[model samples]
Target chain A: MATKLARRRSKAAAFGVFNPNHVVGGRVAGLIVAFWTAIALLLWIASPWKTLPTPPEVIHALHDLWWNDGLGPELFTTLKLIFHATLITTVLALGLAYLTVVPAMRPLVQAASKLRFLGITGLVFPLTLLTGGGYALKVALLTFGMASFFVTSMAETVLEIPRSEFDHMRVLGASELLIVWEVVVRGTLDRALEVLRQNVAIGWSMITMVEGISRAEGGIGALILNENKHFRLEDVYALLLVILLVGLGIDALVGLLRAVLCPHARLGKVRR
Target chain B: MIPGASVGEVVLDVKEVGLTLEEHLILDGVTFQVKDRIREGITTGQVVALLGPSGVGKTRLLRIIAGLDAPDSGTVRGLQGEELPAGTVGVVFQDYPLLRHRTVESNLLLAGSIGGLSAARSEARTQELLKTFGMEDRAGFYPGQLSGGQKQRVAIAQQLVVPRRFLLLDEPFSGLDPAALEDVSKLICEVANLDEFNTVMIVTHDIRAAMAVSDTLYMLGRASKNGKHVPGAKIVGEYDLVDRGLAWQKGIMERPDFVALEHELRGLFRTL
Candidate 1:
């Protein structure tokens, strides 16, 4: 009976792509990833379109961009801008979201969240006039672009919190301010991290456009625009790849931070 | 064998409490009182069960008592004989909500601090409660890592960390297996015996489980008069197991009288 049970367990773990509630082992999962990669490579090699840059060309362009074109500094500038914008967005968005607990602040928060629907192109002129159109403009544009999304997600996180949690805090003799601190601020910190992680991607995607508005401080966005204008398709593709890799790295870092700071966020159903 | 139990002055009084949501009467004229239970000169606490079928306003009534929700009519009086103030009563929700971002220890510590414990005292109380709940080893574990039963234990312990006189549990025995059910029953009894002023009101549909752990049982359902069903739920039945020689008895389920009462309550529950 023991051997039969073991055999059943092993079989169940071996292949479970189509099975609900069945998780494949690490080896099986790795194999599945490799299979998809192989198929993607074959498709890339066989594509009829020749205008797309080949892998070898893209790699050579990457080497040139790194060695001669100051891609390193440009990338650094973009990252720095992202860091500042994210810091400001975090403060502003969180303040607005947390203040929603007060009846008077809800309409203002709702207005801020609704600003996400407004296009950045229309607001760029006004923002440039407001910030005098320099590095300040870049940072302002990025912050403006990101804060609405951050507020939207963070506000939803606060709203979705079960009423019972607030009640639980009240029962613990928590005052209204303490309840906000415990249930809203501290309770949603991990979720805030997750929301930040998601919005950082949006920041990355928008940086190039924001940088175009004020080209005094050169960033990857400015570099991409320069390359694209010159019809340097290979360099453009290489810069795109660089952005992808950097975005993935930032994502991994945020995930690591969440794991360390909120280790409980990752845990799910440990079978005794 | 009887544990020398005696009832004292009422600590909680609900008089003519009524609620209406969207033109539908949920609870009307729901009145009851929980008195201090003294045994051998120690306040061993009293466990009261609020039993009813689903959607019978059991949860709503519990909320009103905890001051989380306000009833349209009537008032809930606390030990001071005034309107029950927010933070005066502790509540354990049916889903056993805990801070998912925090470890069990951090969650308890926060509760203690909210309960007005000093930092040093909060830490000591957290450690003690962790040990009491058999969660000392899992103190670093997150709520998501623990099973349903473990989360329930943490939820209960979170309340006790602050020395609350009253705790309300909604559906404490809903989804437990038999062994877990037995464990929770014992845990409820142990908590009740921890303090003389401590009172637990458990709202559940599980008649047998509630009967096993509670000294007082109240049923909520609509009354009938002159062949017409009443519009709202109220305290339709009340039983004092202490007077019936059934309170605080181990292996009470095996008693013939206990089985008979279970059958009787089961019949009464179907009517609700």
Candidate 2:
């Protein structure tokens, strides 16, 4: 009797009508339906003149802009800026976090934590003096903007590491550099990636502001300014969609990277 | 080096080590030495216990010995030098801080790689230690999945996966039931018996557990005098468990000599 019931369930599953495991729970499915429905209704209401960009029109504009209007290079430039800024921020944050572990350098870390309230946008003109308003200025702005938060998060991550792990590494006669690599880096890589993921979004959000202020050529921010100047609302929507899609893509890539780098996290073994 | 060194010979001399943190002394003028021992032509390592009450600097002293912490005024010399050679000391921390990012097998493999062992040798040794610790079935399990006793066993086995002349176990008997404690004690004795670990120091508050597997015992304590707080830990007592050979045999805890030693250690703690 049990064998017959199991066979029936398998047959039902094969037909796609009675899957024992649903793709989403009932509540989640309902929420997703409600969310998309609300979006559709909002789009309809906002398109009284039927110019709020249908999906096909947006896709067509995206294709035309990406292929002919230099959108690809501008997009790449913005991404490159974010990428380099995140890299520099990570290295600086890690160095700062390492220093905080030293008793003598703890005061420095406390000072850095307090500087988080200083706005990077406010530093635009001051930093332009140090770096003559090009890639360096923009990169510097983003890195400085994100650095304090990254350092604080990374330092907390470092502290959350059980001291015993560091002791264990030292007992193995590991050199200072080796301990940094084997214990600190490996122990905190998962959370560090998380910090980067969160900080990169903030960096991206500020990218357009910096680029617009600098009037940088060949960037999404410049492109947005150009579109806004011409009153091409459809093209503006298309560019906004491009930015949204790119941000979501980066997020997905980071999630995949995290999964590969820290499989233990997927197993729910990470303490936080 | 010794004039004519035997196998498993390691000499440790800790001289007048002092450390102060934030105006509170943790270890002041602490000194001890472990001489090489030869028993019937077999060079046996000395398993010593750093016993003290809670809040004393037993773990701090162990950290100093492991080269994890710097002493304010003294030096720890092993193998007749200022420093212990790489991969000569392996520590099992009080919390058994196994790598959360790796499984049991991967943790051992990581230690092996850090010690610069060849991959084949590391793989072979990891398997051997896993089997020895009765964790053959748990090689793929993460540390978070293990019970307290299993985590302790894996922690010890992870260290043994690499070659080391000294093994330091901090509070190995903590959070164990009576049966688990006995089992872990036997495991420690077996590891200390191996020729690789020429010196073993266990920092523990459980006097009976410490006495069970250690061949020598040292006590650290803090005392107040003249209405002033005494800074740092001081060596209070030393006992040679080697002189009581029969106490090391099975059911030694039930024996009168073991009971008497326990009472004496308790009395010593009371005085502190």
Tens-place lDDT per residue, model 2, B1-272, is 22233323347888898989889989888888776655664546667888998888887787778767778888888876658543567788878887788899998998888778899999999999998999999999988788889988998888888766678888888888999888988887778778733677889899988888877788888776885547788887778776655334677778897899899999888666
* Position A116, candidate 2: lDDT: 84
Candidate 1 C-alpha error for residue A60, in Å: 2.5
Report clash pairs, candidate 1: B43-B196, B44-B196
- Model 2 residue A156 CA deviation in Å: 5.7
True contacts kept of 2: 0.69
- Chain B of model 2: TM-score? 0.90
- Best candidate according to lDDT: 1
iRMSD values, candidates in order: 1.5, 2.4
Candidate 1 lDDT, tens digit per residue, A1-272? 99999999777666557677666667877888999989987887676887778788989999999999999999999999999999999899999999889899999999999999997989988887898888888888888888999999998999998887887777777888877887899888889999989888889888878888777899999999999999999999899999999999999998898778876666653422
The candidate that achieves the highest DockQ relative to the unseen native structure: 1
**Model 2 Cα lDDT, one tens digit per residue, A38-131:** 9986886577776477666777888888898989899998999889998999899888987766779888887887778988767888999999
